[model samples]
Target: MTDPVRVVLVDDHVLFRTGLEVVLGADPRVEVVGQAADGVAAVEVARAARPDIVILDLRLPGCSGLECCRRIRDELPDTQVLVLTASDAEDDLVAALRAGAGGYLVKDGDPAELVEAVLGLREGRSIVPPDLAARALTDLARFDRQAAAGPIGQLTPREREVLALVALGLRNREIAARLFIAENTAKNHVQRVLTKLGMSSRAEAAAFAVRAGLLSPS
Candidate 1:
């Protein structure tokens, strides 16, 4: 038989963490190896246990979920992160993905789906909601059309391509693969696009893409 997936739960709420331990522990294929009440402890436990997957919360006391995700990706490259958050804001989702989260799930999601998402991550697949995916695609398309006709029409085709992907919630590495460019090259293009558009972050780019009708509404 295959080994069970090792998981570490991280959240600020003690009650929530306890409840999750009970639920996830009951699964035959999942083993709850550790639990942390905040991001700091989460990182420590993750490093110690070296779990296959880390179930992380978006908001914590010491460090935010986005920062935590970045740290986990850097420190535990082998472990996948699945984000569980109460916020469904597009910006938050984009931020989490950019920080290297393998999955993004709202708190209201069914327990079964959450477990399934964790299993899917273990199987090497990401689990983003269908609605979020549709929204991302719409944002990409909208950004494309607007950039084609806007004053910034001077942006080269390649820059426009990078812009659309950025608006679609893709990270540098993912965009690099999709565009057939080096990761550093992708990062450079994203930086240039942000500078040209006077934006500080990808979230701003996404919002601009949406407001400009560069993306279709889902």
Candidate 2:
């Protein structure tokens, strides 16, 4: 049998944290390994627990949640972060992604989504609330279109090609088939594109591509 996924909860609210523990605990596939009431203890508990995922809140005390997220990711490269907060602002989402969070969800969603988010992160999928997605993309594209000028120049010709295909919503396999390259090579190219662009995920990179006219605007 597969081992249960270990998770750490980092939120300041006692009632909320306990409620989350209960919800996640009901799923046999997940195990709640630790809890932190603030940003400072967040890092310390996460390091000690060494969980597979850390569900953090953006509004934190003792230190900002962004700093905690960044520190934890820097200190533990293997552990993924999932931001669970009440804020649905695009800036918070962008900042969280920059700090290495793998998923972002607002507090008002169904509890089942939280479970799904945990599973999705474990399976290497990026998660964001469905409602905020379109707005986030268009706004991100507008903002990044300007910022991408300097960073976009950093990408090689081949990497630029890869970014365009990625913007077209092609998966690594499809990109490989289209370019007559190995799937792993396509994946590597995608990663290099994101890294050079200083973007955290394919979503952000794709938005940049759309604004730059690399992909036809839909």
Candidate 3:
């Protein structure tokens, strides 16, 4: 049998963290190794536990999730960081991605999807909401035009579709439904778009789309 995907969760909300632990623990493919209530504790726990994936919250007491992600990326290069948070603000999402988050998930995401994201990370895939992915591409193009030029204009046709929806503020699952794809597949596209554009967040991508006239004011 394949080894379970080891995971450590870091969030300030005790009830939410506990609930997540219970939910994730029930998955035979996943193993909940440890939990931390704050970013400082999360870093320590992550180091000690050395789980394959770290599920982190963007907001936390003492250090913040972005800082924690940066630390984890720098120190534990082998451990993937997945951000699970309530905040969908473009800035927060981009910041976390730029800081080296392997995946980004909203708090209201289905438990099954969350489990899939953890597993996907182990497979060397990145997971992000579809809307965010679109935005990342749009932003990358804009950043390229403003920063220089050349290859930024070469986004694939699918990336353009994703960016248009991102400017509209749709979520990942919503995008998946619209495109007739699994949520995980949609996330994979978004991660690929972000990485290609050298962007870290959806907000940055949205702004770029607007400037490029890919999305008009609603």
Candidate 4:
């Protein structure tokens, strides 16, 4: 049998966190391995637990959820994060995605969908609410053409290929499989692509690719 997806729940509300714990724990497909009430504890718990997914809130204490997401992702590339919060602002969504969060969901969604999100992130999929997704892309599309073109030109043919895939929302493992290269090689290519492009997150790269005509919006 396959192993249950390990998850760490992070939120400032004790009642909400406990409720999510009960909701997720009832499903055998997931195992809630740890819980944290603030950003600092969130990172520490994630480092110690090394769960398949870190589900957190945006308005966290000590540090913003975006910072925690970045730190955890930087330190543990294999561990994905899902932002579970009440905020549905386009700015927040874009920021979380730029921080390398694998998924973002508003608090009003069904509890079952939250479970599905955890499982999906475990399987290497990016998740965002349908209603807000288009708006986020539009927000990202506002960069000046000169800014986009200069960095786009700096990429090698291979790095460009990697960039295009990242624009298509392919994770490193998926990109490695598609390009017939080692996962670490794909990771390096992605990092180089990001650095050469002067981008912080894959969302920026994806938006740039679309603006550059390397990828079409879905």
Candidate 5:
């Protein structure tokens, strides 16, 4: 049998965090491994617990949830992050994605949807509310086009192929499998692609690909 998904819950509100814990814990498929009430503590707990996913909040007290997301993702690349917050602002969603969060969900959604988002992250999918997703793509595409093109034109043909797949939201492991390469090799390719493109996150890389006409929105 598969192991339950280990999760670290982070939010400043005790009642909300506790309620989510109970809600998510009721699901046998998920295990609440750790909890934090602030961004700094969230990072520490995540580092120590090394859970499968970190459920974060944007308006964290010690630091912005976006900062914590970046730290957790940068320090623990194997652990994915999902932002669960009350803020539905487009800037917040875009920032969270750009900070390397695997998914974003507003607090207004049903608890069942939260469970589904957690499971979706386990399956290597990015989750966002339907209401925000379309506008997000349009805004992301615009952001990419307006940003100065870095060394993107310097990428080799193979690297371009990888970037296109990234734009399609393919993770490194999936990219490796599709291209018949080692996962580590795929990871290296992705890192190099980001370096050459002067982008910090896969979300940005996808936008860059779209702006470059290497990928279509459809």
Candidate 6:
């Protein structure tokens, strides 16, 4: 039998944190291992708990959630960090992703959606609220497009080709078949593209490709 997904909750509000613990605890597939009201304590608790997922909030006393997320990710590469906050600001979302959060969800999101996100993150999937997805992509592309002067130029010729195919909406398997490379090789190329472009997800990378004219805008 598979083990339940262990999770750590980090939020400043005691009531909110308690409510979340109860909500997530009700899931038979999940087990709440620890909880913290601040970033510093969050990391300490997480390091000790060694949970499969961390439900984090952007606002925290002392260590700011972004730094905490980065530290947690650096220390626990296997643990997925999911940002659960009330803020819908694009900058917050972008910063969270850049800090290595695997998922982002507003607190106003439905309990079912939040539950799905937690499960999805454990399965190695990136999660974002459906309502914010399109805007999030546009925001990420715009931010990177402005901060990065010719970000595509940073990629090798082969990576550029991979990015273009990604923009064309091909999955890794499809990209491998189209490029006549091994599937793992295609995935590596995609990872390289995302790393070089400072993109956390393929959606951001695809948007970057279009913005950079690597893929023709329709």
Best by lDDT: 4
lDDT of each: 0.77, 0.84, 0.77, 0.86, 0.84, 0.82
Q: Against the correct fold, how does model 1 do in TM-score?
A: 0.66
True-structure RMSD, every candidate = 7.1, 3.1, 7.4, 2.9, 2.8, 3.8
- Candidate 4 C-alpha error for residue 9, in Å: 0.6
Global Cα lDDT for candidate 5: 0.84
Alpha-carbon RMSD, candidate 5: 2.8
Better of 2 and 4 by lDDT: 4
Itemize residue pairs with steric clashes in candidate 6: none
In the range 109-143, model 4's lDDT, one tens digit per residue, is 99999998888777655677767777776776786
| lDDT tens digits by residue: candidate 1, 58-87 | 999789888887888789977889988898
TM-score of each predicted structure versus truth: 0.66, 0.81, 0.68, 0.82, 0.81, 0.76
lDDT of 4 at 184: 95
Per-residue lDDT of 48 in model 6: 100
Which is the winner by TM-score between candidate 3 and candidate 5? 5
The 10 consecutive residues of candidate 3 with the worst lDDT sum are 143-152
Please provide the root mean square deviation of candidate 3 (C-alpha atoms, Å).
7.4
lDDT of 2 by residue, 32-57 (tens): 99999999999999999999999999
Tens digit per residue, CA lDDT, model 3, 172-197: 77678888988887777766766677
Query: By TM-score, how accurate is candidate 2?
Result: 0.81
- Tens digits of per-residue lDDT, candidate 6, 56-169, equal 999999799999998998899778899999999877877787788877899988888878888877754557665575566667565555555577678899999998887665
Give the per-residue Cα lDDT of candidate 4 at 111: 95
